[model samples]
Target: RALNVILVLQCERRRFLRVGLAVPLLGTVAELREMVAREGHIPPEQVMGGMGGTGKGRDPLRATEVPSAVPQVILAEVSPQGFLRSLGDSEELGAAGEGAPLYAFQPPPARRPGTANPSPLAGNRGLHSLDWLGGQGLPASPGAAQPEAQHPLPSAARSSDCLHRGASSRVLLLLCNTVSDGHRLTRFGPPLVLREERGISWEQLQQSILGQLRALLRAEARAQGMGVPLFRIRLAEGMEPCTYLSPQDPHPLCHPAIDRALQLSGSGGPPHVRLMAEWDLNTKERLFGSVQGEAVEDAESVGLQQQAHRQQPSCTLDECFQLYTKEEQVRGTAG
Candidate 1:
């Protein structure tokens, strides 16, 4: 069976590597960790070192006691709600669920009290500490206070530069409400502007979109007195022709299509972008019914509603926010 694993780095939790491996169902989690280490080109020692646990209930000074070998990389099952349930080393891969998503998190180093944490940029200190002007024969005085070093860039300017860099990394995603009428595809409502910054993995993006849909779906289902249906989000490149972002694609976030779209937006192209979303069959059916209701009514006369069925296509992203707020209010009042 093919196993999908998300490798989380200890230093940078936001950026992760998503990898697929072909392994036997009977294989153990220990074996799985080894495979992940090999696939990612990470050291096996780092994946499963002698040290383990959450650094609790262990004696540090006990020389006579032997430390049991524990996997340094934590293997856990991520729930739809974003909670993690760690898997045991001896646990069978099949028990975790066939083709289920798994996360391999590299644990940060344990820190004890009274010990200082080292800076991540310590290696770069050599560049700053070196005195290039020492050969100029400037005599150093003993027991004299040194002058305060001046920085090339002021602190405020540096901070602003960082801020601008972050802003530049933001991707404006126009989330178009997409659905099918059993024959033809139709997209209604104003596309929502989803601002995604850099350093987020494709899996993280999928989860975020799914979480938003869950809340909206629940609120709508409650408002309509119907069952909440299961759904999935299929990301697409543009509005027309539906160039799908395949789940099998290793780098969906950094795809060439997305790059082209971003480039177009950066230029003097259309201010608005429309990205299509593919829904499951059940969600499509539910949405089609809602669309029928919208066709028969005047959207402006209806005012703000808990179930805004995308009747007003000309509405802006602000109106979409209002719709979500209205739904939240309905859900709150109902509860």
Candidate 2:
């Protein structure tokens, strides 16, 4: 199933360009941002707005008032009551519900000193066919032009978790394998995006990890006649030795140990992908032990395992279990 997304592209001086998109019902906010960037001709790398659009009190009209070295594009949700809410890239689009309106705010091209400001709405040169919506717009800044919009804003405003304020933590997960050659580490897929707002507990995190592993093998299992995947997380923070996660401890995300590690990592950025997840020995024997051994025979012969200590081990998806961390199940409509 798919839904139509009505996106209003907002620029300074009352210029509005509206575009429509047919997106999968299950498409994510990150995917929607990319689609908007592609359709609206936004520079992907320059599209570095925070999770929620510019918060209240910031003037969209003033975005272009100051000279900026680089341009930025921001995506935000407009409520029925005409309030703006920030959207997370990893969130599901359908969470916004039916007939929900979206707005993309981009500043116009930078102007050199002493150049006359061009009228963005004159003759509707930059405005596309508009689905004009009326409500009290953001309070107009002094001397800001008022919009000529006529459509009435929807009466009922629906609440969605997607509009909440929080940043998702992305953690990189790696698998550890020990052979006669020694320790070999490899990353399977993209970094896991933790969306829990209240802080994640150890048990919840473990289930999420195992669930992702099962999803990766489910397709192959059905075709090749295999069993469910099995593995346990053995977490090790940045540059530290590995240790198994225990059920005894809860609220791992809030642990002081993790906080100290994040402080001392010295990267001053998102923590490194140092968390290790060990595959159960019995699982290797039952699932892909022989297949991996055969697939990497040449690498083994060439001492690749020794090199894997420094880099990712060479292997194919078919030769190893892959993990894909995805969003939680969402049920709603998008329009």
Query: lDDT winner among the candidates?
Result: 1
Per-residue lDDT of 1-335 in model 1, one digit per residue for the tens?
Answer: 55667665533212356655666768877688677666555543322213224232444554233334344455555432221244555677786534344656553334324654332123311111111111111122244332122111111111222332332243545454555546754554322334343323333444334432332343444233211112223334223543444333323444445655555432111122235554444665553444321112122312333224335447779987887666434444555
lDDT of 2 by residue, 187-235 (tens): 3322222222213433345444433333233333323321121333443
Give residue 245's lDDT in candidate 1 (0 to 100).
49
Which run of 10 residues does model 2 get worst, by summed lDDT? 127-136
Q: Which candidate number has the best TM-score? A: 1
Q: What is the lDDT of residue 99 in candidate 2?
A: 35
| Clash pairs for candidate 1 | none
Off by over 4 Å in 1: 1-168, 188-190, 211-215, 219-242, 266-273, 285-335
Query: What total of clashing residue pairs does each candidate reach?
Result: 0, 3
Residue 206 CA error for candidate 1 (Å)? Answer: 2.5
* Reference-based TM-score, model 2: 0.29
The lDDT for every candidate, in the order shown, is 0.41, 0.37
Worst ten-residue run, lDDT, model 1? 127-136
